[model samples]
Target: FDLWADAPEEATGHQPQHLPAPKLALPGHEESYNPPDEYLPDEKERKTFERTEPSERKQHWLPEKFAALRHVPAYEHFVRERFERCLDLYLAPRARKNRINIDPDSLVPQLPDPKDLEPYPTRTAVVYRGHTSRIRSFALDPTGQWMASGSDDKTARLWEVATGRCLAVWQLDDVVEHVAWNPSRDLSLLSAAAGHKVFLINPKQLWDTERQLNTQNLLSTGFAQAAAIASDEIMACRWDKPSGEQSSQGILAVLVHQRDVKQIAWHRKGDYFATIQPEEADAPVLIHQLAKQQTQRPFRRTKGVIQRVSFHPTKPLFFVATQRYVRIYNLQKQALVKALQSNVKWISSLDVHPQGDNLLVGSYDKRVCWFDLDLSTRPYRTLRYHRQAVRGVAYHQRYPLFASCGDDGSVHVFHGMVYNDLLQNPLIVPLQILRGHKIEESLGVLACQFHPSQPWLVSAGADATLRLWC
Candidate 1:
């Protein structure tokens, strides 16, 4: 009796199964041949192959000699074995974890042409929880009512963005690295964990969402190797329509070895998605966005993946940040529009001002950096309020205000989103600091997001606490 299966498997002919290829190392970091560093003393990590003589390398005879061999079953088997290993890797993982649960209601609606985000800081809300432990990731629902979270606490929690109430607590019992809210159904969520399995959870459960996890009664199986590439991120999984279903349930995991996808972003509207996969050295950051379904596009490198992906509130421009640098890409043109920098430690998240020309970027080392999209000579103002890493940031939609939270376990509420060229207008003035508990937890703020129609905010932290501020 599989606890996660919806129906009795033997009755339905479904069998329990395992991931097709968790056997592979890191989600995307295995090589055809991995030799020990000691095997190559210089540590150059290079491989050498003898150049074969043309006479020896060339086949003694032409295709006519092999024609007779092609008809034999043995010849066919030999050809199949050549690429079997590569194909097996992708197929193995699917068999292990192929129970994809999708709610029929989770369908993309006909969309209006995208519009520019109106400028005007509208409302400001703050969230904080004074609990121990640190938060690792945050996810937002486009409508803003629900926020799904993953943390070092080995659990995934859901909260109402309007009021930070822990709507649901999913005890994963594994280090949940990423929690992605199904954009279509805020209650429908997906989380990737350390166990190498992607768990689909329903904030609304019981009857329909009861489909269990059974691989022996497998639906489909394929291998998905996990390799520890510097920027390969199995945790940063994405769902794309790709000419099929509009539901966020449809996904196509890109095959990128030796990289971790630290940051991910979806387009304002469409089946397009992008992830920042970085490799050691100067490996190009892969930017994958929607290019209409069926158009198999190549990778769009954004210089480096040290930074992350932040979509424009209403525009097509994308803002990616680093420890001390930022780059803006004109999505329509697929070109680099701006290169800006701030000698900051690490800008973890970027939230563009909903109404004004200002931008708020949170960092691990404290101060939240501020900048103007048009005037990119340098950061316009530095909001030096938080004393610890500020992992979550949100901009008000109508009022001239914004909010930030961090490991300090306090949500700093600021009243100004400055973009004045005269330097007369300050970016954000401290309006208030909201703390959920009198005691500060060891973990600071993990993630924060606001609902589209409410004057409130939702947040999660490593303390496994979720709070809503208004």
Candidate 2:
């Protein structure tokens, strides 16, 4: 038996049980129970829907009793205003005050029209620094491979033009006054002037033998005698110096001048060259022939001191710059062709154009004058751009351009056109002003020349540097 005994149950099969319904509180309450009409009033009772006065509409929503608080105390308002004023004083937008008052047009000079000036040559491609003293003169080879420089340190150095590598260096007994490359295509040689001696050098022979020493394995046993002979030939004329040493030798010819040579100019054919000496100003210009290694007097005595001389590129004519005149002489006829009266007192340098129809003269008065040989003795255009006395002048052989360097430590390049027609005035446009070489103790650019066929320039400065600009 289970804990509890089951009572007898009545069985009502599948019948559902039902409960009584909920009763309403009151009869009227049930009728009024519509949720008090959702507690909504008429449209006039709603503040947002009611009409408002214009002044009331602008006022902030607050109790009317708080109007006195809205009108702040005068002293408190002044203190708050002062605080905001201080903040604004520090935070306001500032007006920029210019330190320099400049006129736009005066920043740079108004360049000439019709002829476009080239961009300035400010990019220095190479800085050659082998010269111990001021570089007095330098010349670019016709092939544009090497440049030869002469310095006051009594040395003449050959440099690979594109790389600025020193290939060979030769020492001299005195200051090297000038360095020039043989213009002849057949002869690969260089000429350097020191005191009264001019040395002609064959670069290939010197450089080729120099490169052979490293490859010969000279320390080996059997080839000792051959190496010894080669070594003697290398040192035959004292051609080379130890590394970092300055010495000179191995020259083709050394021509001695009677007096100190002030300037040297090569003939167009490269077979002959001329030298000017102060002591021989009254004498004819001395012409030296490379083939015979002989010096000859070609021109008769002129009136004034010879300042500079240049040979025409294509003609047999040569120009002589004197104190007050520039004279042109024909080598074949040995006669004066024209006398260009340079009204200036001192003509410092002169250069002949490649076309052989124009000449440029630079003077001590900071003036560069261009003369048309076919037009007149007077200058067609006189430009006064340099600040100091002109030191050197050069004309590009391939371009219609000319350059002038002065003691002011500036180089000015110009485009000068000699028109074929007489009615057209020659257009003279200033292209560039190159300034890099510093003026130290009154030294500046002493010499400058353009590459024969390329748009490049090489300048020798008194700062003992050679800068190449392209």
Mind giving the per-residue lDDT tens digits that candidate 1 earns over 298-405? 233434446566677577787777667777777789778788887687777787777436777888888787777566647877877788788778876655557788
Candidate 2 whole-model C-alpha lDDT, 0 to 1:
0.72
How high a TM-score does candidate 2 get?
0.66
Give Cα distance to truth, residue 251, candidate 2, Å. 0.8
Candidate 2 lDDT, 1-470, residue by residue in tens: 45466643543344444433333234332122232443443455446534676345532221211134445333334565567567766576445455998899898755476235453344579999988799999998777878899999999898988888898788876899888877865556677878866666666533456322322222122123333333322221112211222213445455556566777788878778887875654443677655534456665577778888888888888888889899888989988899998778799888888878888889998898889887899998788999998888888877767889988988887777667787776677777788899886787898889888777788889999999887
Clashes of each: 70, 0
- lDDT against the true structure, per candidate, is 0.53, 0.72
Model 2: pairs clashing at backbone N, Cα or C within 3 Å: none
Best by lDDT: 2
Cα deviation at 215, candidate 1, in Å, is 23
In candidate 2, where is summed lDDT lowest over 10 consecutive residues?
238-247
